[model samples]
Target: MKDRRRFSRVPFKTEVEVLFERRRLAAKNLKDISLKGLYVVAPERPPVGEICQVKVKLTGAEPPVELIFTGEVVRHGPDGFAIVVTETDLESFAHLRKLLSYNLADPEKIEAELGRLIR
Candidate 1:
């Protein structure tokens, strides 16, 4: 099958907290991330198209920046679910960009990927 993803995803294992309802939160492992989305490894799968808030703490950073974003459940499977980020704060986007740059071997590749997505 052809890959339909808009951005290239890199393996990123980290803690993620998903809030789908009021006073309810689920802690899961972030399996991977791209500029547009991320995959959360959790047993409880939310229905597709559901909008939720996700918070990811970047532990590799010095102060461990926490990124908060709104995302929609795009795909689901036995292991976990994939969320397409719909909104993010400026600081959160900056942190995510930094994290991706640190994890990827070639930063230019990400630039190219983003370029492709924009076009």
Candidate 2:
């Protein structure tokens, strides 16, 4: 199958809390993340096309802020579900950018992908 990914993903295991509709779901296994989305390993998977809010708390941030991301559920399997990022606040975006930069060997690749997405 042809790969349809826009941005490269990196391992970013962390605590993830998702607000699915009016229900709150928590997962400890956040498999990976890209500039565009998240892959969460959980017991429950929301239906495809459902929009959800994902939050990742930053323990190191001096003021303490969580990276909030709003995205649509694109795929789900027995192990986990995938979300395609649709919205993010400025602060969260900055935090995500920095996290990806720190994890990726070639940080510029993520930036280039962001540029392409913007255009």
Candidate 3:
């Protein structure tokens, strides 16, 4: 089967905190992440198109990295919901880059995958 994903996603497991209406926060497990978005495993799925703030604390790094961003719920199913990231800072981008670099081998493959995302 052909993979239709734009950006290459690496399998990542981490705890993610999502804030929805009324500043209520829910903790969920993050399944995977790409440059564009992430997948969160949640029993109570949020409505599609709903926007929420997400905080992901990535450990195992030298000093750890915290990624805080706003995203929209693009898909929801039995497994979990997918979030399309809307906003992020430079620090988050750097951390994501580092994570991908560590997880993904072959620089040529990474270049090709990222090139597909641009086009």
Candidate 4:
């Protein structure tokens, strides 16, 4: 299949601290993250088409940068669901990209790897 998404996906299992509507919730792990959205393996799946705010607290970061995105649950399951951010917060997205780029070990190497995968 031809990959159409304009985002590179890194397959890494990381535990993330998620917050929705000021409510603390736990997801299984992060499935993938792009400039547009994030997929998580959460057991407690939210209803599809429900719009909510999400904040992801990632490890290896000094302080948690709140990611304010208006996303709707697109998929529902026991494992997890897919959520696409309706609006792109440039500031938050840049912060997240920087954070991920730092922990990626080698930015150039990973980007090349993802490029191959995407192609």
Q: Compute each candidate's TM-score over C-alphas.
A: 0.89, 0.92, 0.84, 0.65
Which 10-residue window of candidate 2 scores lowest in summed lDDT? 56-65
User: Which structure among the candidates has the greatest TM-score?
Assistant: 2
Per-residue lDDT of 1-119 in model 3, one digit per residue for the tens? 99878777888998888887756556557888888899988887778999998889888766867888889999996888999988888888777777887887654566676576558
Model 1, position 52: C-alpha lDDT score: 92
Task: Give the poorly placed runs of model 2, Cα more than 4 Å off.
Answer: 62-64
**Deviation from native of the Cα of residue 22 in model 3, angstroms:** 2.6
Between candidates 3 and 4, the one scoring higher on TM-score is 3
Give the distance in Å from residue 99's predicted Cα in candidate 3 to where it truly belongs.
0.4
Pairs of residues clashing in candidate 2: none
Tens-digit per-residue lDDT, 12-116, candidate 1: 888898888563456558899998999999988778998999999878768888999999999997789999999999899878877788788898777887677
After best superposition, candidate 2 residue 4: deviation in angstroms?
A: 2.4
| Candidate numbers sorted by TM-score from highest down | 2, 1, 3, 4
For 11-113, candidate 2 gives per-residue lDDT tens digits of 9878899998899989988999999988999999888999999998767768876899999999997899999999999989998999999899999998898
Kindly provide the TM-score of model 4 when superposed on the true structure, using C-alpha atoms.
0.65
Which 10 successive residues of model 4 have the least lDDT summed?
109-118
Model 2: how far residue 83 lies from native, Å: 0.4
Residue pairs with backbone overlap in model 1:
none
lDDT of 2 at 82: 93
lDDT score, candidate 1:
0.85
lDDT of each: 0.85, 0.90, 0.82, 0.66
Instruction: List where candidate 4 sits over 4 angstroms from the true fold.
Output: 15-24, 100-119
